[model samples]
Target: MSLPLAIISYLILGESDTWFTTLGTYLYFILLPVFWVGYTVGKKILGIRIVNLDETDVSFWTMIKRQLIANIFYILTLGIGVIVSAFMVGIREDKRAIHDFIAGTYVTFHPPWQK
Candidate 1:
């Protein structure tokens, strides 16, 4: 995903622009909401889904909040956020990332038969 954006930036803005990297960083923020919605929607289609820590359906606002926090940490950390995010998931009792924690959400395995 970032690859295409990088390529596009290079093509349009010239490879020499330092702002390309900044634009790529901003692009991440732009993609977060779209990504979360797509991820949740896809999970629903697959009969597995994400919910809140309380096992309630994830709200759009919550998803946005989660994405915002996670993205901020990601941008600030200069890509180390992936590792931190993954570690957050591993350490969480319910297996949630920092985004999930901020959003009060959890991903759970749901069998297709039950859906």
Candidate 2:
């Protein structure tokens, strides 16, 4: 999604700093997951999705917390948090990463229940 937009942006604007690129990045990485059953394009392709632990739909704020707030910890820890998160997901019984705990969410292979 961003790739085509980036190519076009570069062609037209001669740089990737345009609003189109920013919008494409945010739409694909953030908003899409909030509205698209919690699955981004890659996650959907991988047959997994994020879900709230309470079995509710993942809200916009929750997605923000997951995507933005949790990332702060990852950055502040000099990326150790990210490494720990990967280990936790691999070794923990619940298979949850730090972001999942912070956002009260989990990734699951089970498809969301249709209305």
Best by TM-score: 2
lDDT of 2 at 68: 84
- In candidate 2, how many Å is residue 41 off? 1.2
Q: Indicate which candidate wins on lDDT.
A: 2
lDDT of 2 by residue, 1-115 (tens): 7788889899999996789897777667678878898898889999988889976778898888887889889999999999999999889998999999889999888788741
- Alpha-carbon deviation at 102 in model 1, angstroms: 1.5
Cα RMSD of all models vs. native, in order, equals 5.2, 2.5
lDDT of each: 0.63, 0.86
- Backbone collision count in every prediction? 0, 0
Q: Give the per-residue lDDT digits (tens) of candidate 1, residues 1-115.
A: 4566667778887773457766665545435434553244346567556666665555557666776667787788897977877987788677777677767776777532333
* Deviation of model 2 at 90, angstroms: 1.3
